[model samples]
Target: MHPPSVRSERLVSPTGRGYLQLESHPAGCFRGVELMRAQVPAPDAPPARRPTALVIGSSAGYGLASTITGLVRYGIDGVGIGWERAAGQRSASAGWYRTIAAATIARDLRSNFVFRNADAFADSTKSETLDLLEERFGGVDYLIYSVAAPRRTDPRTGITHQSVLKPLGEPHTTRNLEFADDGTALLRDVTVEPATEAEKAATVRVMGGEDWSRWVTALAGRGLLRDGFRTVALSYIGSPLTSAIYRAGTIGAAKEHLESTAVTLDALLAGFGGRALVSVNGAVISQALTAVPGIPLYVCLLRGVLGDRFPSPVEQSLQLWEQLTADRPDVDERGRIRLDRWELSAAVQATMAERWRSVTPATLTELADVPWFRTQFRALYGFDVPGVDYAVPVATDLPWPGSPAR
Candidate 1:
């Protein structure tokens, strides 16, 4: 039913020169999951109540980390929803392998874990997930919305919306990183034009809070929300260096919509003692960010400025869980969690800005953690993970062990 075992190799651009990785290594992906899970210490004591969670977009990046943290640290049962390709002629998506590894760990910990490899934006996917939650867990106590997509098809309207990364008022010119065929890093100035009104609207449709609201609405309509239910959506507000291209751009407009949705959802859930919040997370290397203009440069520079203090996706997710579960959750004036406080500290921003002004091809290595950035980028697709023997052949067509609706 699947392809034979093969030794996975790193594939790049069709022209053989670019930052895009075209293939995934299952072994490395499993190793990556293990590494992240290792960072979360087991709870000192069992939780007061074992909660059930539903993690949308829960296969990679912060979504995956949050899943692992919830399962391992809090002994939470979960249904993780992610859209990833199963292994075929090429390899399964890195997220596919990560889900398998996570499922294995959950089994060992005696936690009920279900993974659904289906479109999170579709009504069918939501219905199927809700069915599983109703059948197995009674209802969901926590909902984590961490979807990052280039486009989304509105299940209700049968219309598709694509997201764009462009500034609002004027074109933004910034230093960007380009990799040579030999993987040498090069600096170049790239100019990104402003998004049209239609494009801005499209971006909000794809990346904004509409889908999150829909999910919550669907769950509420199905009577699947447990008492004291809590929901969170991940967001980012970067430093001024990339603000024009990020926080002030089309994505920023979408984030504003997302934040406003949180306010509405909080009010909607008030009767159940539930809350909806947006956690402004720190910048971390993610597949979604790599595709965005100027984010790579900003993240690299941020890492260099923070050095060892830079928080990983898993670390930040663990901290987020602690805060959300606290008796008096720490939140800003807008009722948003601020996990980017370290990255946006005055001293960190000042140093990053100074380096940004003088950074060039010659000084990129000195001013930014280029090597770390590259490694992290590769790790997203299951490459360069420590202890993974790439020489060995791996079966790419592994199936989810106990998924009910895959």
Candidate 2:
């Protein structure tokens, strides 16, 4: 008689469909689930997937998530647009971090991806990008515009405008922000800043869609954009509380311009069946967003309401991909694929407003909780990268991709 055989079985999810697997590491369990849920194939090349495109700012947050969605969810080999060099020697601006992470993820996923690391704001960088496009895939089918910066320099005027977060109207006194050394909890006091007219104007000019228009025009001029090509840029519309710092503030002005720029670009691309859309996304906890006044409290408050329904970067990007690829005849007169309709959902916003009312300095400590704040803050910079050991030394010497165009 044979010795008693040992067997083990574990329930699993593939293609996000339910299955059972025997003997898998606990840490790796999410693999089967994520793969199935996201719908990436094990053998790869199951069906002819949509031709991939180029994504600017494709290293972290929404940009990174979009890149992954292109590969895993859509099975498209994508090129990320980024800036790898700067005037000064400060390594690892947010963009650099994004590019590095994108490269690593692309490699792991066995996707044919390339990082077109250059100053996207500069003509030289743009030329280099064109060269890369010519050599690599001949052309890109989609362009995701997710570039974010605090300043912009006009090549024509030769004037540089540094962006700021000061609110419009009178000297705005808002909460002061002080974070613990351990990056745990934040302490707030009423902070005040007087915005000069020039400061406000500079903020708008830098954040506005003037540059976005230039980019689309440049790409079209090069004849690099394929017919039926599309591009998307992210925008935001916030509430009254945030209006001082976000919506009605300097950033808000810029975002308004950005939205308008989309319409203009759509007209420009209409000839080739190309279009530009502005995605007015919900507020996410990005590195730059954390710097905004009152956003910390806003995030904490929103979290209580959004709960699990508030999508993560990955989910958001997946939705964006679906919007880009799905067969739909619906087009609004505004010429935008309106994700903002869902973003500004009445249920979500109503809940957020209620939560906002309940938050205060005294109650915040207990209501928000320390761990939640820490997690959100750390998540901003890819610090809590899943499956990566946080204790491991991340090299500072890594060449950062800064906006050399700035």
Candidate 3:
């Protein structure tokens, strides 16, 4: 019997093995991807063939931020896959507020962007992506996987992998965080859940290496990758205090699988001279990370550290773009990209670990926001609303940074 990973709908590509097209919601009467598709290249734009890229989970948090960075920093016209209404409340499927915010920002810059609402984890979504690549652009040079979800059933095996965030092998209690209606100060309470072996496996199955491999294999089969084409996925290594709930816990197993997949993918793509990387990114409040076992406390702690100097998902994404398409090499010794390298430095970790030893639920806010950590947390979800006119009723119908002409 096939493992639970491969048993899905066997996403097939009837269209050329490239991108996917989405059902345009015309009745909404909103201008979105259409406006962003036609802007001419700026005179001072970097010299090169127009690079094409695709970012899955491109609605909120790191996903959305990365899409904007790709457009504003690099000239890579790309497609964004996520479930966001053009305007509405922030849903787990798609945070329309962030979508609109990103769209508004993209418009101000006259970018080429397209948003496709799809469940990126599914075989159907893969097929749709293939269609989009074929019809929209000839192919893609880069693919970014930043999906965050709970469960996935292998279409082939019908085995469902359900994700969980709990302490491993211990009945640990964590403070449950609840934000007030005004999104001001957070309230905390003790919460308990013992992560079982099944939960660990489920987390790995849902967030681990298999689907990523599938994506690369499918794309390579269709000739979507360009010369020296690249792919990247994000990972994290938090302080030891949260390690039990993060890297060493259920999600850690998934990351272990994911990191290992990079090497496997390198071998698989050896013929194409393409490469895959696992970027060790800093912690940020994407919809996905918000619900993790120990993330809220960690986020609060890390936010207190970075202060204004920290990087937002948008900024981190721009840095990531520079690493991919630019001549820059900002990777660490391990050849993996490191966005939170400095902030998570040996000195910082040592300090934070020491601080965590004495930290309690009462002191979370006080200790979470060191100058370095503060900036990092603020950068997670674009919460530090800058000079942008938040008062003005903004709309998400802005230019996409890297979308192709329809």
Q: Which has the greatest lDDT?
A: 1
Off by over 4 Å in 1: 1-17, 403-406
Clash totals in order:
0, 8, 48
lDDT of 2 by residue, 145-264 (tens): 887777777767878889998777766655533465544455565554757789878877888887778777777887778888888887777666677878877888888888898888
lDDT of each structure? 0.86, 0.62, 0.62
Top candidate by TM-score: 1
Off by over 4 Å in 3: 1-44, 85-94, 100-112, 175-191, 326-334, 360-366, 370-406
Tens digit of per-residue lDDT, candidate 1, span 246-303: 8899999999999999999999999989999999999999888877777788888888
Better of 1 and 2 by lDDT: 1
| Candidate 2 segments whose C-alpha is farther than 4 A from its true place | 1-50, 84-98, 108-110, 176-178, 182-184, 192-194, 329-335, 338-343, 382-406
Candidate achieving higher TM-score, 1 or 3: 1
Model 1 / residue 152 / CA error / Å: 0.5
Which prediction has more favorable lDDT, 1 or 3?
Answer: 1
Task: Give the candidate order by descending TM-score.
Answer: 1, 2, 3
Model 3 scores a TM of 0.75
